[model samples]
Target: MNILAIDTANNFLSLALHKDQSTHIICEDIGNKQSEFILPKINQLLTENDTKLQDLTSISYNAGPGGFTGLRIGLSVAMSLAYSLKIPLYPVNMFAMYHNALNTETNSIIALDAKLGQIYLAGFDNNGDYLIEPQLINPEQLSSVLSKHNLINDDDTIITGNGWTAYTEIFNQDISSQNIQYIESNYPSAATMINLVLSGKSQPCAAHEAELLYLRNKVALNLEEQKQSKQ
Candidate 1:
């Protein structure tokens, strides 16, 4: 099966083409310009590989809890292509993409910086099975949450993601005694995204159903408050 996988949920913009069990990827840490570069890169990849959008069996993307703008661009492209080509669109979780890149078989916690002094977090076991549902958490609450799951006492636990890089001091202070190892890379891989779909880890949805995996609901001010603020 020929599959096109995209990952623009973070600072990295990655696109992969899977053909006959081999994968080709265009990955770069080009922050915030994914909206500008993604489609051109996709066209370049297909043209260079002698493939066309119509040849794609499926379209997969990093459905996110990462940067809101990046996620929107990725979903927009994926859904548009899938709908036009009449192919299924697959939504892969951003955290699971991170977990798939880990070299360790131990318990893994994937985190992404959620800003507002919080982090997006999820846990997976050695087999890549989710242990905790993804959530946004304040750094100050790190200790209690891990302890609640007994992860605080588990030395085999490893934390990996950009979340750690952005809030190192807070994580170090809170979980240093736990002896959890940290890996430096946080960017999700389009190659891994393809591997995930090939292994049946991702599910395909209708193009209209393709949406960002935001863990939180939309926040809005009340009508009276909006009027007061405007005044």
Candidate 2:
């Protein structure tokens, strides 16, 4: 099976082409230039791998809880390609991808810095089951959330993601005595996303039904309203 996976949910733009049992990936920290770089990179990957879009069995993408513009660009392109090719589109959560990549044996918190001093948070057990649904949360509130779940003092608990890199001091100070480990992975793996689909963890949907998982919907709506007011 041939599968294509895309992840433009953060500063990194990741693309992967899985053909047979082999995978080819292109990952770059391109900041805000995903709109300009993603398609060309995709084309380059396909061409280099001697595969075409029509040859793909399905397309998968990181469906949000990251940067707004990046997620939109990724989903629009994925949906359009799936619609045009008449192939299934699989939506994978960015946090799930992070969890899978970490391949950890302890309870984990997958977070992404959502800007405005907020973090996109999701928790999973040592066995990779959801401990908490994904949410946009302030740094100050994270301690309480962990305490609520009795995860605060668990030495086996670890925090992983770009969120830690962005707000290191805040987390260090807030949860200083917890003895939790932090891994500084800034972006999820595209290869991991493809593997999730192959393992049946990701279910495919119609192209038109594909959508980004923007956890901060209310904040997004408010920003839109503010923009309209200025206009």
- Return the top candidate by TM-score: 1
How high is each candidate's TM-score? 0.90, 0.89
lDDT of 1 at 19: 88
The deviation in Å at residue 188 for candidate 2 is 2.7
**Which stretches in model 1 have alpha-carbon errors above 4 Å?**
218-231
Q: How close is candidate 2 to the true structure, as a TM-score?
A: 0.89
Q: Pick the candidate with the highest lDDT.
A: 2
The CA lDDT of each predicted structure is 0.85, 0.87
- lDDT over C-alpha atoms for residue 133 of model 2: 85
lDDT score at residue 46, model 2, on the 0-100 scale: 99
Candidate 2 per-residue lDDT, tens place, 1-231, comes to 799999998789999999979999999999899999999999999999999888998999989777788899999999999999999999999888988888889999987888767898999997778897898888888888889888888888998888777788888888977877887664557999988898888899999999888677687676777789889
Compared with the true structure, the alpha-carbon lDDT of candidate 2 equals 0.87
What digit string (tens of lDDT, one per residue) describes model 1 on residues 1-231?
999998888788899999877899898888889999999999999998899888999999988887788999999999999999999988899888888888578998887887655788999888888777799887877778778777876877888888888888988898887877887774657988887898888988999998888775542334455578779
